[model samples]
Target chain A: MECMTENGGYAAGCRENRRDRATMQSVIPDAIEVDDIAKQFGEVRALDGVSFGVARGTVLGLLGPNGAGKTTAVRILTTTMRPDRGRASVLGLDVDHDAQRVRESIGLAGQYAAVDESLTGSENLWMMGRLTHLSQSASRSRSKELLVRFGLDDAGDRQVKTYSGGMRRRLDLAAALVHRPSVLFLDEPTTGLDPRSRRGLWDVIGELVADGTTLLLTTQYLEEADRLADRIVVIDQGQVIAEGTSAQLKARIGTTIIEAVFADPASAEGARTLLAPLGELTDADDGRALSLQVNTGPRSIMDAVGALERAAIEPLTLAVREPTLDDVFLRLTGQRVE
Target chain B: MVPARARVRRLTLGWTVRDSLTVTKRNLLTLTRNPELVVFATIQPVLFVLMFRYVFGGAIQVPGEDYVNFLMPGIWAQAVVFGAVSTAVGLAEDLQSGLIERFRSLPMAPSAVLVGRTNADLVRDVFVIALMCVVGFLVGFRNQTDALAFLAALLLMLAFGYSMAWVFAVFGLRAPNAETAQAAAFPVMAVLVFASSAFVPTETMPGWLQVFADHQPVTAVVDAVRALVLGGPTASYVVTAVAWIVGIVVVFGTLAVVRYRRVT
Candidate 1:
């Protein structure tokens, strides 16, 4: 990125980015580059000036509430849907002008399994191979290999309608890889799976990234993002609310939460006033309890606890720990989501 | 390692057609596995031939004497049109199911997947058309047109079958769901099949309806098939029918391709 900058700073990276964009190399170290892209559906604006980028091979967790444009952005980058405004290129190919090439370079598993119910597991995989422009011999061979790898070889000859949901999702992912795309887009890949199966898929995704495939995953499950993503991006109403490494985003919300259980309303009132200086204090779920979120250190925690006890509110419990991604999402989007 | 031109051309018609054919073969295998669908898809066309040829065969008369000969051409056209619809429904289902989106991610030609699907539909329609002919023969229907003329009729119906697919393709893309696509296409299918001279001679119909039906392109197509199969006076209609088929191809073909671009 630096070599292209003769004037130093922006000039080098700017020139390289332009060259990379023109040549279709996608070598900006960022696997995805999104500018002010937005989309509208009838009266609703699905995406509103959303922009973010993910470096190569690093899983960027996409999180938002149900109506958020998480899936919409994934669809745009995967070349399945074109944005009405703003330009998006995956692997340096403009989605509109070079969709065919972009498609070849990226693999997408949408929110649902798009497998043909009539086709057998083997036939579905082979069909994907054929659709990917593979020869008869090559498609057949690749289908066989993927079937074995995905643990579907035993059910390969059975119809897809007969396969379980987990098996179907696995087959869908396998089919996406028939062409061996360097970039893989998964839109809520683990939505309906049981815990075991979801974990199984998580392992598969990790292995894929380890193999150098850059993955852009849109998931609502906070744990899925926390487990897989190198960096997490929180989007709400089609705009980036916040983005950072998982730790950085969490740190933004502060550490240490103090929980105090009051004997009555009188004690709870006093606890709130006593804990004011430690940090932000708020009423807990129950009317008799109050909690304080503060920085992670003994001075803060001890002082906060001492004040609460002195206020005649004998604490039920008190603890200090770092904030989770949920707090980060709440702080940025004004709404907490799973 | 290959040059850019060579790589892009690697996905051209020659290779894409091979891919399409292989995809069609796989789909055919999948369909054959579902014996129920194969039976269900072919049954309606066969029943149409049997019911119309025997029950209404004698009641309806052409300019020439024999009802069987007259019914043969009409039944063939009807069979081809009806048989092609299964492919349209299949395409709609694929769209709803995410199969088309999955296909878009591949390096294959966009036309290739649809072509493969059409190929399977054509194969299925051809077989169904032939079966209806057999059923037609059982009920005393016969084609007196020479072998070349009969071949011409088959070619016309086949071309019409493939061309009719574009209208349904648009529906399949635009419809919110597969079930809606199936429901919407049938009414249009019924209008064309009924509006044309598929069931009765346009001359025998009520005067105003006759004029409208006669001038319509489907009527020209039916007239060509009738002339080709039963040796009627439809030479001019055959020329007009070919032109009509071409026009439908261009118009609806554009719509289907445009709709595909929108969806993708």
Candidate 2:
């Protein structure tokens, strides 16, 4: 919880206007804290000095591309794998020294669904509950509750192999939640899922948060992080490149993009030169479109329009928009988040 | 309800055993649901019993005893050993499917996954062995010993089968996938079952091969069961069988747990 007092103060203050929000902030504490964890797999350094923390009841998105060590970090924090150096804790218990204690307070739903394919959905959850030391009656009742909650009531008695991808993912999540763990780790929970299923999982995650479970969610989807993360830490090539709220990260780009699609490539090139002084200009879509990063926000559109008028270059379309998380990622990591 | 903080400190040996049994129940449930697997598993040993009893029984002679009596113990030894390979295949599937990762994340004992899998497979070996015994009876195999001796023989077979399950449990965890597990298990199983007294008499083999075939674990188990079932000097063979079982369980069970800790 020491990390929470330091890292969560700013986010908590922003919500302090509401009485309930302030109470929640004061009541709960840091649920996960990872400090300079470094792990190496032979010649490849999977994680190097990666550090972050999640406040209780908040979602901290570990945003990175494939092999960026998001899953590695999640594994270390969940006590399923140990880091070669440094330390992590879940619910204030050391992951390495007090691994069993840490495990008792946390649940993990990995990238792939981990439910037994041969077992029915309810049976899978019940088995998980029993493993967590619930009594038989309690396990059964809890399994029933979870199956109903995950919208799998009708499919509860069917083998997991008979389930659709989405249903299986839901069952996996339900299995993790069997003991109502105080903290949860979801490593790309919706990776291969369709949009509808992804949204369904997001809703389930939202509900978990609402019930005050701290979550560490790792995903390559910028939009998923933007929608769900209270705070985000971007990792690339085994290092933390940036850490902030989604809006804060977006603000780091510090420019509005003014994009103008001209009728012809020559006009687009001409417009790029004309608007070069306003901001950085680059041709997109094989010179069919021009995008300029201007610091003047909407005013950049007016400037572009005025310049085009004087040049007698009537652009087909013009728009100005703020930089997105994608721009922030591209600026920081020199690659798209995906 | 216990507070979360309090529960974190409450891990006990009893809880570990309970959790392992829970995992065992889950595995056994799968067998019940997939009846085809059981049917296929039983079919292989029955085929072995029939092929050996009728096809090779007349040609291979054990002096002063019916061929069926001598062959049935060997079949039981081979059947349980083959049944143990399923433990490897099942564990490999669990590892490849990410179920092991799920279990690793739980607060349960780290040994539970291995213990549960081996325990379930032993139960399966017991059932398969009983079926094979009925098949043995139909093929003219008879037990001349008392009820207690027969019971001891059954227990010894199960104990040996459980140890073999651990041996293959190590192989299963090391295999990249279920198919590879099955492939890896077959050659070792073939050598142990075929080279030992489980098939042809060890005396009929060549000098060097006989030395190994007579001393190997499978031969010891087969000889012990044969003596118990056919009324012979049983004490020495029973001690040797127990010793083999204990040795296999210690060596391979430790190896399996070590591999489980290191696997992803």
Candidate 3:
């Protein structure tokens, strides 16, 4: 916040700071770099001057709602689609001129499970291995290794059409890894999975990150981004609206939210009126839940508690919670992440 | 030593062939695993053979050969053309399922998917045509030519189907889904199959219709196959048929590859 005054203004100072960092990081360029890329389909602009970079061996979560150009960005980076404008690169190779080399260095698991349903899991992986130029023996061994790693060894012989949604996704991810690519692009990898399956996938991703795999994950779930991302870039309507660490982005709205749920709307209204001076209050559904966003740290909760106590209103629940990525998304885009 | 650029080009060409064969193997494996598909592919041609031979055999006439002899080659040509429709549907299914995107993102050859799919369909055509020939034999249709000539007829039919596969490959990439691919391909198939001399003699048709029926590629291929099989002067029909096949392979092969590039 002080940089606003020190560097003259908000937008200019932020841009200057980013330029400085980018210059510094240019010593070792990002593993994945997208520079001012744009794409259009008929009349709809799918991606409009979007740019971002992912450092090596770190996770950069691309957060957005549907139609936010996340998949288009992935497609461009994966060399499946070319941008109408601008350039992208993977592992220091230009994606357009050296697309084959770029493909050799990156793996992409698309929004849908792209595994061949008619082929067994092992066969699918083996085919990917062969296509990536692995020898027959190497491909066979890698297929077995990936099936075991993804917990699909027992089901490896069965056709992919027989596998569950989660199993199919795992196989698809494994197929992408057949060449042991350095950079991975997962577009909504857990979109349709149940909670348990999503968690299982997150664990696999965690292990990959631990093994120093650079990942660019696009996700609609703010929780998924918060849980996995070291840095986050939020895009909406084909543009980057905000980007930072989860805590940094959350700080844009407020540091903490003091929430209180009353038994009735009358009690909530009374509490909101009494606590009006504490900070900014957003009344929740049906007016039974009230949340106060306060930049003041722990003391803000004490202030809210003292105010409610002074008013003689008994609330149903009261808790001080850190602001979530959802709050940042709502503040930036004026809509929920959904 | 070879220049680096030439060496890289050679390696790329080598990988293109290898990748195409790998994909062809995958498609053939899928076909084998789905027994119902094999059953239906064979059954439809057999049904066509039986229906035309028994149901419509009595009314049709050829100039010199038995009606069954003329009918068999036409049926084989029709079977091969229809077999190519499955190429369209299969490719469209891959597109809808995101399998094509997956393949495109890999480091493999760009032309492999289309080449592999058409080649696999050609193999399936061979199987279905062989069964149709067996059905043709049981129903009193016999080839008047030697074994080598019969083999040449078979090869010509496969070449015709191969060209149609390239044509449908373009339709598949243009369509949004498998059902749409089938819908778009069938009407064209009907036009080619019926407007030609596949089911009846072009000479028996009215004068204007005969002009089209005589010149269309399907009729040329069918007439070529009939000449090779039923013992006649094969030179002109074979020349025209080969010209059509080469022209279609050049034109539609380019269109299909272009459409594939624009898919994602």
Q: Give the top-scoring candidate (DockQ).
A: 2
Please give, for residues B47-102, the per-residue lDDT of candidate 3 as tens digits: 88888888888778767878888888888888888889989999999999999999
Q: Which stretches of candidate 1 lie over 4 Å from their true place?
A: A1-28, A258-292, A302-320, B1-10, B232-234
Report the lDDT tens digits of candidate 3 across residue range A1-338: 44332212224344345435444544676888889999998888889999988877778899999999999999999988999999998887788988877777778998789989999999999999989888999999999999999999999999999999899999999998998888999999999899889878987887887687889999999988876776789999899999887667877776688888899889898998988897888868777998888775778788888888888898999877776788888879889986
- Clashing residue pairs in candidate 2 (N, C-alpha, C atoms within 3 angstroms): none
Q: Global lDDT for candidate 2? A: 0.86
List model 1 lDDT by residue over B80-197, tens digit each. 6665666667777888888887776667766766667777777776777777767877878767868888888888887887777665777777877768877888887877778778
lDDT of 1 by residue, A135-190 (tens): 77898999999999888999999999999888999998998898787788898899
lDDT of each: 0.76, 0.86, 0.86
Q: List the residue pairs that clash in candidate 3.
A: none
Worst 10 residues of 2 chain A by lDDT: A1-10
In candidate 3, stretches whose alpha carbon ends up further than 4 angstroms from where it belongs are A1-27, A261-270, A284-289, A309-317, B1-11
**Residue-by-residue lDDT tens digits, candidate 2, A1-338:** 22123322323444232224423664555678889999999999999998887877788889999999998998888777889999887777899988887788889998889999999999998999988888899999999999999999999999999999999999999999999898899999999999999988987887898687878999999878876777889999899999987767877877888877888889888887888897898768777698888874567677777898999998788776667678888999889865
> How good is the docking of model 1, as DockQ?
0.48
Ranking by DockQ: 2, 3, 1
Query: What is every candidate's alpha-carbon RMSD to the true fold?
Result: 7.3, 4.7, 6.0
